[model samples]
Target: MPGITSPPLPAPDLIDIHCHQLSGSDHRQILSRDVHELASHPIAALDRIEALLTNRRYLSLGMHPWFIKHQTIETAFLRLKSCTHHPKILAIGECGLDKCIDTPMSVQIEVFSRQVQLSEELGKPLIIHCVRAFAELLQLKKSLAPTQPWIMHGFTGKPALAAQLIQHDCYISFGKALLQTGSQATLALQAIPLEQLFLETDAAGVSIDTIYAAAAKIRGIDPINLRRQIHSNFINVFFND
Candidate 1:
């Protein structure tokens, strides 16, 4: 398979905390690619990571619960662990619990726990993907007490959920859902503390700029100020600088 490719671009003040497909925008993005997608070709996975990093791109690698298989978990996780040390690999997930998936909750917990441990061991933050599993997810967070930040990406939950997660020190990221008027995401975006928030495109195929614009409008702020605030949150969470 072809490795991920992108041309060199100037460093962006605006940031996309998580995305699957690369966009043709100038802003910085942390691409979220599953390690399991290339499990059979470890070299290709490494090469893709290398190419992205070589071109000043960033990414987060993880084994998503939806793709978790008893047969492939070990091999895929080994592959994921091998690449965690790279500086450009900013976070350890897109991984978390999902009650909607057919995968057993026990198995999901085991895999997600492993990644959580890995993230802690490596001192990297997490980009989380959660669906209808907040209870279990919050339990894990309380028990683990991980020092690194856990960003709940692509959140479309109500303001209460966003507030709960923020109270626990987890950052919430909004995506294409923000563009939809009267969406839970839009309402939550308005209520979320600016410092504990982020923006993304996920696999939505929308431009990060569009997401930012929608988010700014919902929060009654200029796009440029929104960009600056999110960029600041990005640095504080990912780089701790």
Candidate 2:
């Protein structure tokens, strides 16, 4: 209801594919919201989302695996479903398998699977959050064969893993890790095809422009070119539908 009547913002030069906090400036972004956070206080969370949509902010909504408690799943998922029809809700994620979390792998898989179905049904991209569960994630992708894009956000994996996910048609998004010397993200960014790549700040508390500059330096290209390529990637994935 909010974004439906509001005018869309101009195309952004720099796109932050996934982040928790919204920047004050008019940078393009997919602001992520975990449904777990909405379970206990649904009205408050939905109100916040409405305010964001009213302001013409794009959103990605999903249930993060780490916070998947059995009691809250129904409530959280219903809230997630309610928000998906909003035009400004661009993706269905920041969700997926995380092997290190205390939540059982079985539970994580089930919750993530539901979100996967929702994404496919709505024809929206999925922004994933994976940790030490590449094998399981890949297998699920293979089995499901979703038509929508799945972006691996905040990636810190090695080049081999990055290539494997790209091969599986997943876009890789680099974050603050790219700023570190000799980091896996920095190295992998150099190898990833520009079309299959994206950049984000996630919850790193850094400017997206800073990440773009660091990534451009690593890939031996001008920051303007990197920004342009990522803007193209963002349109292909987020607006293709």
Per-model TM against the reference: 0.91, 0.90
Query: What lDDT is obtained when candidate 1 is compared to the true structure?
Result: 0.85
Per-residue alpha-carbon lDDT of model 2 for 121-158, expressed as tens digits?
A: 89999999999999999999999999999999999989
The clash numbers for all candidates, in the given order, read: 0, 0
Candidate 1: segments with Cα more than 4 A from true spot:
1-12, 54-56
lDDT at position 93, candidate 1: 86
What's model 1's lDDT at 67?
A: 84
Task: Give lDDT tens digits, candidate 1, residues 135-200.
Answer: 999999999989999999999999999999999999999999988899999999888899998988
Candidate 1's displacement at residue 122, Å, is: 0.4
Residue 108 in model 1: lDDT = 95
